[model samples]
Target: KLRERLKISGDYHECNETNSSLLLLTENNTSLDLNISRDAVFGNCLDLAVKKFQKRHGLVVDGVVGGGTQRALNMTIEEKIDKVQLNIDRIKWLPREKNERYVIVNVPEFMLHYVEDGEIKQQLAVIVGDRKHPTPIFSENISYIVLNPYWKVPEGIVRREVIPAMVKNPNYLKKQGLEAHQTWDENSPRVDTSWIYWEEYLYGQKKFPYRLMQPPGPKNALGKIKFKFPNKFSVYLHDTPTKHLFKKRVRAFSHGCVRLSQPTDFLKTISTFNPKINMKKATKRLKGKRKQFIKVKNQLRIHLVYLTVGINKEGQVEFRNDIYNYDKYQKRRIR
Candidate 1:
C-alpha cells in the first residue's frame, strides 16, 4: 500500500534513452519515469520548474530559473503545501481588483509580467535583491514612468558602497558619472571639503563629505526606464544597462530595486489595459523631457512567490534547487 501510494510500480523505468544518466526516482525495486532530461532534472529542471511555478503563481513566465526558484523547490512537500496555505492567508495582500491592466514583479524568479484581460501579454527578465537584501513583498498601482531620469543615490548605498570607493579614489564618483554636492550637517549648513580629507573617511574617523548623484545616460545604473508607484519603502521597478546579466540561469544580482530586461514589451502590455492611454502616446511622452503618469484602467495582480516542487501543465511533479534557502526555513516554520 505504501509502495502504491509512492507510485513505485515495478514496470516503471526511471531512465531516459536520450540521456541515459538522468534519474527521476528509484524505490521499491522500481524506477520512476522522468518528464525532462537527466541533466535537466538536477540543473535546468529546477530552473524550468521554477519558471512554470512562477507562471502559475502569477509571475513572469520566463523559462530560466534562478535562486528564488531553487530556494522554493528545495522545500519539503509539507513546506510547499504550507506556502500554498500562506498564499491563501495573504491573498488580501493584493488589491481586490486592478485597473484591468498592470505589471507584476516576482522577486524570487527575477522576472516581471504584464497581464491584461485575465491573460499574460508580456514577460521580461528582472534582477532582484540578493539574500542579504531580500526584495520587499508588496503591491501598489503604477502611477507613472520616468525615462532618462537622474538617479538620487540612496543613503544606504552611499554609506555602504559609494563612500568607501570614494575614499580609495576621489575620482571614482566622476568616473561613474556621479557629481558631488556640498555636504550638510543637522543644521543643513554646508561643510568645506578642504577641512576633511575625503580619503580618510574610509577609516571610520570621518563623515561623508558630500552628496553624490549619477546623471542619466548609458552608464547610469537605473538604465533608461523607471516605473514609479506610491510606496513608503522607496522601492520601484526599472531597467538596467547591464543586459548581460539576464543570460545567467540564476540571476539574483541587484540591490533592493527590481531590474527588467524587456521594458518596452512591458510598457506596451500595461498600456493596452489602460484605456486612458494609448501605447503610441505613451511612447511619445516617454521620449520627451517631461515625465508622464498614465493611470491604468485595470490594476494587474502581482505575486512574488517561491515554489520548490510543483506539477507542470503536463501534470508532472518537478523538483528544483533551494536558492534562497526558503525551503529550509519553511520546513522549520510549518508544523
Candidate 2:
C-alpha cells in the first residue's frame, strides 16, 4: 500500500490527496515525521518532510518533486528490497571480524570513512574514477605516504595521450614539466625529448623504450602528497591539482585514482594513530620542493566498496545511486 501511494510523481507545490498521502505515508513508513496533517494540502510541514527525505537519500535537498526526487520516490518496493539484499551480500563478503583500524570508501556515495574500534574518526569527500575508468572494488593496506610526489606517467598514458599530444605540439613536454628518462629508475639519466623519435612510437612503427615522468612541482598531477598502496591497479588515494572539483555534488571525475579534498588534514589524522610518522619532517618535506616517501610503520587496511544501500549513523536506510551499475551485477532472488 505504501509502495502504491509512492507511485505518484512530478512537481507538487500545492496540496492534493495525491501529494498529501504520499508525504504522510512516507513520514509514517520511514524514520521521518513532519507532524504533517493527513489533510490534502502541500503545506510547510509536508515540504520539510520532502527535504528531509532527500537529505537522507543523498539527493538534492529541494522540497519540490523534481526528476531525481521522483525517480527515487518511484522506486518500487520489490526493487528496493532487491537493492537491500544485494548490498547485504556485499557486506557478507567483507572482513568477518572488525580490525584495530581500517578505512572504507563507498564508491557510490563518494565518501571515505576512517573507522577505528567501531567509531568514525574522520570523514572526507572524494572524487573517484568516472564511468569509462571505474574505480575497482578491492581491499589493500596503505603502505606509505609520499610528499612532493612525482607524477610518474604510466606507459599506457605515455603511448596513447602523451605521444599524440607531443606530436600535435612540440613544446608540450617542456610546458607540462614532463621529463623523458632513459629508464624507470631514480638515478636514470634524463633523455632529451628532442633526440627521441616521437613519430615512430606514436605511429606504432616502434616500441617506446624510454619512460616519461613529471617531476615534483606545481604542474604535478599528484599535487603535493599521495597515499601509496602497492596494488595491481596502480591506483592511489592522492591530492589533486584540480581542487575545485570537490565543490561539485557528484564527484566522479578521475582516471582511476581516488582524489582527496583534504590531504594535509588526512596526513594529520594518520599521524595521530601511527606513532612512527615524523610530523615535523613531513611538514619540512612538504614545504620543500623535493620528492620523499615515508614508510608506514603500522599499515592501515582500506576497502574500496560499492554499496548502493546501507544504514547510516542515524540508523536510517540511506540510498546512493548505482554509479558503476554494480547493483545490476548482483543476481535478484526469484519470487
Model 2: how far is 290 from its true place, Å?
1.4
What is the number of residue pairs that collide in model 1? 17
lDDT of each: 0.59, 0.80
| Predicted structure with the largest lDDT when compared to the true one | 2
lDDT of model 2, residue 227: 99
**Global CA lDDT computed for model 1:** 0.59
lDDT of 1 by residue, 40-154 (tens): 5545553455455655543345533333422443445665556556545545455565456556665555657675666666778788878877767777767677666667787
* Top-TM-score candidate index: 2
**Residue 123 of candidate 1: its Cα lDDT?**
75
lDDT of 2 at 69: 67
> Which digits, one per residue and each the tens of the lDDT, describe model 2 over residues 88-188?
98899987546778889888889999988888889999999999889999999998999998788988888888888988998999999999888888569
